[model samples]
Target chain A: MPRISKSDVVNSTLAFITLILFWFLGFWLSHYIALPAALLGLLLLFMGLLCLGRVPKPLEYVSQFCLRHLSLFFIPPLVAAWFYAEQLGNNLWLFLFAIMFSTFISLYLTSWLGQRFFGHSNQSVSQDDES
Target chain B: MTKVNTVDWQSIIQLVSIEQLLWITITLFAYGLAIWIYKYFAHNILFHPIVVGAILIGCIGVVSATPLQDYLIFVRPINWMLGPVTVALAIPLYQQIRLIYAAGSKGLLVIIIGGCVAPLLAIGWLFLFDFSDPVKLSVLTKSITTPLAVDTTNIIGGIPELAAGVVVITGILGVMFSKIIFKLTRCDDSRAQGLALGTVSHAIGTARAHQIGAKTGAFSTMALCVNGILTAIVLPLVFMLFG
Candidate 1:
């Protein structure tokens, strides 16, 4: 049987602890540290990533784990948005217009430009690779 | 004297109720549990634990009437992770430095033009519809990630919170349709796909770009970082000069 690595234990433990810390931090910040909470959250996130990098050959697995379940973490915020539904309702037209217009515009431009710039580079790289 | 000593526990208990602490613990444990489950069955795309967990939490919040704000207080820490996740893209980015450099001034020119044109077109369309200034500004920031979009919205006199909502909506829509759009446009090249997505749709676009392959994802990540900074700087100045 393969020995259970110390790094594996540490990575799993850290990921678990960070999730809880993030929640408590969010809760505390909503009441006590709105802006600071956001700042601190960003800070902790970077720290967590750094910790993730220190883990072994299974780093990809760890990242996949986070990505797969990342949306679960945002539920609280969505719920918070719901609580403010009345405010959202009052500004429905503005919100609708903003979301719709921005979505189309952003998607179109990003895709189009990304294609243009990267296409040029890819052509050059492939030519080099073939040679 | 003994009676006097026993008189004041109720107020203390009320100050920090066991029930509230229990609720907080439960919510945190749920997040941890969700992560574990997602890890267990990581192959299925639709069953993405994050989405599943979000839906579950949202349902629970609705049933409990636990003010979203109260839950936000507990969940805000997750948002904090956004910064690191974003910056970490720099790692993949560093590996692609050669490709970026080789693209050179020509590549820079293309990116700048595309970035500028995309937002202009978006804002122009909104203007045609006679949307309010706040709405227009919010739309302008939608092509970037939520954090940057929120900040850009504020600088340009739009509501940051409103920008956040727009960013989420924009990401979902972008992710859903961008591939179809790419196919329709006959854009089969990875680099072009990445840039177009990153420049126009922002993070969601980048995510879509990644789905195509590593080359596309790398370029999209680059586009996201560059476009984010460019728009943040340029949008405010454009508004100042023109608006």
Candidate 2:
């Protein structure tokens, strides 16, 4: 295992503080605005952090770690899904069909539109799966 | 071997209950197992971790009669992490800003079209059936990712939980059928495909896009952020004016 440093801890702590601050902003703003507070906070914080002159190196590492395990956060919601499972009752097929069909249409239309209208002038044909 | 009759295994098991620790252990184990299965099957879309884990937990819940509330009690920590996890998306967004700017007006147009068309298609399809308003609303936000999808649905007076479920399902479908859609449309542009996947399917499609290439992943991330913002602003206003 690699040695953990104090700077890394500080950077991660600062990043978390930023997240909490934004989350609270979103939470408070929710009273007046219709948008989800945490999401709005996320957007605001992203812009702020992006525009900052001195971006912390540790922040990047911390954020990468969080994003890599994004699915872990989703597990709770999936579990919460059980509460509403009964809501599907008889329309489960309809629900599934609707989601599948709409997604298919959306993907088709969006991509087709991108290709048809925008062309590939800016797109590179080379594949770069370096990650 | 026949002398150990005094110990009651049932009492011990009941006394421990195991519900508190069960959530963390079972969920991680189930997700890990699901990923293993997915890999074992050569990353078959059918064996996606989310789907498999959900099924595994669902079965366990049904058989064991574990109340959803009990699960929620221990799962709260994971749920609480969502806010921070969402905030972390900003890092990718920041990194991809240059590419997004490079696309310029054309990219803006694509994002707008995708933002509107996704939910409109949902609304139109639901209308064809006899679905209730809440159901329609839930499906309306299916195109975006979870945090934004839940918010959009909530603003539109829809069921947020239902929207979250549908949003996840939409992502899985996007991952599974993207190739077919690309073939049918004859759109060989990987950038365009990434944009579509991210705009319509969100994270799952982004994961697929990354599999395709780095450029595709960047474009997909751009689309995910842009579409999320656009839908968050546009969907409710459209519903209000002409719903």
Candidate 3:
């Protein structure tokens, strides 16, 4: 009984087409151009969004969509790692050490510095609440 | 005349086989259709179309015995665009200059500490565990986004492609879980949230932070840019020293 909003149709269609178009464009650029496809994909995304107007809700929906499903995009690449399994197999110990070690280090350092820089000292609290 | 022409007709027919052409067309059409279907069902979660399409393509590649490298040749064109897109991130950094200025020395200090510390921690931990050179190099760049991570890895004598993989994984994990970690730790302020997300997750984390609030996004963007530059300079130097 309700009429379809023109804006909704346009936005949804744009959203749907943009992803495929960008994917193909990224593939084409990566193959022919000397640039990385992810960078180009992002550039086209920004430009496309700009041209699509400042409709906050649709844009928000699109971004949320991207965030939630970020992992799906990388599945192909991850599976590609299977092809290199032989090489990785030989270097299994090294890979394990690297992933574990680096993850811990990044986690610790970020948490520590994050605490120090943004950490709430008594002075910061008093200064803020004093005003 | 027919008998004379028949002598070469076989070779001509083989050169333009309908079956082979039809197969190629079908593959291309299938890929397009899969992507379209993925986009339609994304529904703003882990089911996003790009992710689904990637999974489908990957499964197809495995099932068909297609060499991942050959498929990459097709995907590489899209992958190459990562550079300019990174440069474009600078626009947001420029826009947030006023906030950066407002936070002033304190903000600069926070960025500096985060930028310098994150890579150091990753590299140092890898070394302590005695990881191989390539793996070490890959992990060193994990705190950044894919494009920059690849470039940084290449410059630092690591495998760029491998680095890209690590960067993607790191980003996914960071984006998905950092918020829960933050909430658990009771880090509720925008500044702290931005710093934590940016420091641990990199660009994707920053995108997540942006969703929380403007200040958080601004700070997260700053963290991404500053950390990127710092890691670019510092990681290579550290690698030279220990690597």
Please identify model 1 stretches exceeding 4 Å from their true place. A1-4, A7-98, A109-122, A127-131, B1-54, B84-86, B117-136, B151-157, B235-243
Q: What's the true lDDT of residue B66 in model 3?
A: 70
- For model 2, residues B1-243, the per-residue Cα lDDT tens digits are 577668888898775456656777888888888878878988777877777887887777778887877776766666666776676677777777776777677777887777777677777877887778887888777777787777678888898777777777888888888898888888777678778888887888888888787778888888998887777777777777887
Please, what's the RMSD in Å of model 3? 9.0
Lowest summed lDDT across 10 adjacent residues in model 3 chain B is found at B43-52
The candidate scoring highest on lDDT is: 2
Most TM-score-accurate candidate: 2
Cα-based lDDT for every prediction: 0.57, 0.76, 0.58
lDDT of 1 by residue, B1-243 (tens): 454556687898787656556655666666777667756875233444434555667777778876666766555555555443433333333334566676567556656766666556666766666556776676676666665665567668875655665555555666666667776666677777666666666665666567678777767666766666667667776776887
Per-residue accuracy of model 1 over A39-104 as CA lDDT, tens digit each: 334335445655655433343344455543434434454444344435656556654655565555
Instruction: Name the candidate that leads on DockQ.
Output: 2
Worst ten-residue run, lDDT, model 3 chain A? A122-131
Indicate the residue-level lDDT of B82 in model 1: 46
Prediction RMSDs, each to the true structure: 7.5, 7.6, 9.0
TM-score of each: 0.63, 0.86, 0.61
